[model samples]
Target: SDIVTSVLDVSQPCEVNIAIYDISGRCAMERELEIDCRGEVEIELDTGKLSCGVYEVKVLSNAGGDKSRFVVVR
Candidate 1:
């Protein structure tokens, strides 16, 4: 199982894009959300279809973000 945690200090309403990619840089999953103002949110990832391996996570927003790597094991 995997989860995504996103924190934002938005000054106005906007959209955020989140993505997960395999080690080979293939997109595995992606989500776009609409949020307002400033807040923090957690998203549950359905990783049941994925095989055990390493992956990269990313967040795209006006407030800037970082990418992280993670591993899933069977």
Candidate 2:
């Protein structure tokens, strides 16, 4: 499974930091994504070796950031 989110109102092309953490606040995954400044952009998290459980997703950019939770079921 993958974690999907959107980054909107991007003013310029830049790199955004995407991180995923488990319920215990342990960092499970991380990635640096290069995105184009469109009206709205869809970002998908590469689950990789993540296990099935509840996790939090954080997307941070120079513009702003957001946090949310998702479940990865195998």
Candidate 3:
């Protein structure tokens, strides 16, 4: 399994949303976090529960409208 993490820069305190999607493009897990300006965060993803295939991890900063994507393999 693979673990994914990312750092985001937010201008203000807001909610951050992270979602993990399986090979079928279905969201498997969702997490929300509160971040402050210029704050950094790390997220550990558990890929063991997923099948041996490709997965997509998306991070979104709700307040700043920022988004990022990552690929994971199990």
What are the per-residue Cα lDDT tens digits for candidate 2 across 1-74?
36456444566887889889999999998888888665677776677578889999888888888888888887
Backbone Cα, N, C clashes tallied per candidate: 0, 0, 0
Estimate, for each residue in 4-42, the C-alpha lDDT of model 3 and write its tens digit.
666666667778888877768898888887765565656
Q: Model 1: clashing residue pairs?
A: none
Candidate 3 vs. truth: CA RMSD?
2.6
Clashing pairs in 3: none
Scored by lDDT, the top model is: 2
Cα-based lDDT at residue 58, candidate 3? 71
- Model 1 C-alpha lDDT per residue in residues 1-74, reported as the tens digit of each score: 34544454555667888798999999998888887655555556677777789988897877776677778887
Candidate 2 achieves a global lDDT of: 0.79
Better of 1 and 3 by lDDT: 1
Give me the runs in candidate 3 sitting further than 4 Å from their true place.
64-74
Candidate 1: where are CA atoms >4 Å away? 2-12
lDDT of 3 at 13: 77
Task: Estimate the TM-score of every prediction.
Answer: 0.75, 0.79, 0.66
Ranked by TM-score, top first: 2, 1, 3
Global lDDT scores for all candidate models: 0.74, 0.79, 0.67
How well does candidate 2 score on lDDT at residue 21?
94
